[model samples]
Target: MKILIPLDGSAGSLHAVDYVASHRQLFGETPVILLLNVQWKVATGNVKLFINQDTINDYYREQGMLALQPARDVLDAAALPYQYHVSVGTPSDAIAQYACEQGVDQIVMCRQGQGGLQTFLLGSVVTKVLHLAECPVLLVK
Candidate 1:
């Protein structure tokens, strides 16, 4: 089974990674694991013109890569094989979109992300993903 793990460098997100790593046997050989980090889109308007699109995208990609480090460590420690991806956009939407595009059978992720206030105001990322994902979603604590 292919599993998609959406990470945001939070303790909860790392818990999901540990959970998957601990239970790696359940997936058997060649189970595909995808680690994804989504960077928030920069607000639009006049400010965008001052920053080149390439530069903005590069910034996001760099941040996204950094955010994946913890999860990557967990996977590496367990000696598990996996692939990773980074995207720029709303976390929930990007995660769901990637899952669908990759034909992932399941999405294992944290119930909450790093942005507490934003999550409260915008609704939890998991909530949005659960509503939008075509596949099953398993939310870790």
Candidate 2:
């Protein structure tokens, strides 16, 4: 089975990773794991005009890589083979799109992410993902 995990470097996201690690055997032999970190879209208008697109993209990539590290460590320690992905867009949209493109059987993610205020304002990515995803979504709290 192919499992897609969307992580944001938050403790809640790490909990999902831990859940997968603790129950690895349930996933069967050599299950494919895809780790994804979606960088928030840069704000538009005058601020963007001053910043080069490459610079903005690099910043997002750097942040995404940072967010991916812990999950990578977990998988590496377990000796699990996996693929990692990063994108710049809305988290829910990117995650759902990747899942569809990869034909993943399931998506595993946290119920919440790093910023409570952002989550409150933008709403839960998990909720949007559940609605948009064609495959099954498993949310770990």
Candidate 3:
């Protein structure tokens, strides 16, 4: 099975990684794992005018790598082999799109434990991903 884990550098996100790592045997032998980090696309038309495309791309790459670091460390400590990717866009959209393109079997993600008003107002990436992704999604809280 191919599992995609979307991380945002939060403790909540790392919980998902821990869940997967701890439940290794359930995934079978050598399951394909993907660690994906999506950086928010902040270089809009006005911002792009002041910065070159390469510079913006580099910023995204740097931020993406930083966000993936914790999850990577967790997987490494577990001695599991996995592939990782970085992309620039809305988090849910990027994750869903990548899962579709890669033909992933499932998406494992952390659920933000926000309050009622806050969760409703801010929305949740996991919620959007669940609606958008073609494959099954597992939430680790």
Which candidate ranks first by lDDT, i.e. highest? 2
lDDT of 1 at 6: 93
Query: Model 3, range 8-89, lDDT digits (tens) per residue?
Result: 8777888888999999788888678999998878998799789999999999899889889998999999999999999989
lDDT of 2 by residue, 1-141 (tens): 999999997878987888787788888877799999999888577768799888998898899999999999999998888899889898989999999999999898888788678988999888899999999988887
Report the Cα lDDT for residue 1, model 3.
92
The deviation in Å at residue 108 for candidate 2 is 0.7
Which of the predicted structures, 2 or 3, would earn the higher TM-score when compared with the native? 2
| 29-83 per-residue lDDT for model 1 (tens digits) | 6569999998888847786869998888888888988999888888998888899
Q: What is the lDDT of residue 9 in candidate 3?
A: 70
Worst 10 residues of 2 by lDDT: 40-49
Off by over 4 Å in 2: none
* lDDT score, candidate 1, position 100: 96
lDDT computed for candidate 1: 0.87
- Would you give me the overall lDDT of model 3? 0.88
The 10 consecutive residues of candidate 3 with the worst lDDT sum are: 113-122
Task: Count the clashes in each prediction.
Answer: 0, 0, 0
Worst 10 residues of 1 by lDDT: 22-31
